[model samples]
Target: MKDGRHLVWILDDEWNSHELEKSMYNQHGFEVKVTRSDKLEDDMPLYAPCADGVVAQVGFQCRADVIDKLQSCKVISVSGAGYNHVDIEAATQKGIMVSNVPDYCAEEVSNHTLALILTVTRRLASYNRKVREGKWDPLDTMPIHRLSENTVGLLGFGRIARMVAAKLKPFGVRILVHDDFVTEETFNVHGVEPVSLNDLLQQSNILSLHVPLTTETNNLINYERLKMMPRGAFVINTCRGGVINEADLETAIKEGHISGAGLDVLEIEPPSPDHPLLKMDEVFITPHSSYLSEESIDELRTRTTQAVIDGVHGKHLPYALNQVKTETKI
Candidate 1:
């Protein structure tokens, strides 16, 4: 590294756009070393030369064991929405602030949820399947339901959920939301009725998951909860994959307990092609990418990377995780 240069080592290979990062950091005259490897030990070969501090994507493990390898490391940056993979408690104890990019794609996620909902509602997947099978008139088997009379239940009333509801207003669908963080007044603002999970399950014609994954949220929709949803209602999960039990979802869909489902994320990414759910006709699965547009990816990269850069320079984090003070500063 050049003398008087601050080094920021990168552990994410795909984002190793060396030129983009190099040009961006050169303004500040920092040495940017990128070591791209799935295994932390493999980075040992380049550790002394490349890694002064680490900025990682999903591939890099920031666990205590791997983090111990850094020599002059001062900060760790995680580039994605979730920070569960990183041991934030350990980092904080060591006086390193952990940060994440938040709400960069709230619009994109809400738009994607609606696309999934509309695909199932309009029977687009079924139509596409029929054409591939040389069957022209697929609509002969089933009719699309009218959205005007349907009840759309949102599992959480976060910013994205609110956008979904707003866009759904043109359809004249009834909106019900269940988020413990939401206020009754907030629901009244959007004409959304607040309800219990059971009530939401029983009444919704289409349901969407929007909450973050946490201890309280893991497997939130298990067998019993799946059984609770109205038999004909469609379930849409764009939230974290583990939020819904995979086995139970397959069972529920196979038994005709629920009408259909649209899943953007799954328990294990790139689920086996032969997974029972894939064989079924009622489920629409995308390979865990509802936030893949260039715009969103750029925002996530810049914001997440900048958060760590700011922390290293002794500035407050751009979007910190759970570090809100009474003054409400980020």
Candidate 2:
């Protein structure tokens, strides 16, 4: 392990995130390069030094086509909670250990979820819009609801979902979770009742989606699923945009099947100005900032560094995308 030439690359969009990453790697005696850009076509020039090990804040696709351009990329890490941005299967095939710093922002994101729920439920955005538009009497026409004694259905029972459950406990809300990965031991530990998807939709007063976006999970909450939900039920999506099916959600909201939505993500990041969801008074959005906060950033940086170290050392990594361990475990 002595005198190994270490290089870490950050392909992300945070303006000053590079400095923090550089400082961490510099202290550890590793050469670091941070290429920050929001526009892919314009920013390609900045990431010219992308070397052996790559750590990304939000994974940008690193296909074998571009991996062909990269001389040495031993490992790839997603800096945020989600890994869907990375072509995981592609990276795994290239023998690169793809990992994620998943748990660092669990509470922060769950908090954002609740914020969205409260904001939309209370018509915070609608009220703000009316106030800004100089309509003092719009409150009379606003549709608002109370959060007390409601049933909250979760799409997944991951760390973030569990955090949401814990936070909602004091609201006298019943927690109904659905995750094939969650076991009975977890149920006994948390006192959260496991329910099927259909049951969650049929009984929940507030349906919050927390599942990651994947091939099988894409459009998971389509038109049919939305119809199953109780009329006037609120939907909060702190999870992925693709899972809910943008078209289906827009229709559901338009049809008044769902009362409101608190969305932190969209079908496209930084959705176009003309996006219909942006104009909906019943919808509240936050530019995918659910996983962002000062406290979370500090933890994200530290966890990202450790994931890189673990990936390089050929040890187990948290949320590894590569099937190396699955293919060969001791």
- TM-score to true structure, per model: 0.89, 0.87
Tens digits of per-residue lDDT for model 1 on 1-330?
A: 325567787767556475755666767667776766655467565563334446767535667765655545556777876666677766655555567765878888888899999998887888898888999995564757888989999999988899999999998999989999999899999889999988998889899999888889999988888888877778899878889888898888778787788998887767887887888778888876777789998777777667656765767775666442222111
TM-score of model 2 vs. true structure: 0.87
Clashes of each: 0, 0
Which lDDT values do the candidates have, in the order given?
0.76, 0.77
Local lDDT at 83 for model 1: 67
lDDT at 39, model 1: 51
Off by over 4 Å in 2: 1-4, 36-50, 68-71, 132-143, 325-330
lDDT of 1 at 44: 60
Poorest lDDT segment (10 consecutive residues) of candidate 1: 321-330
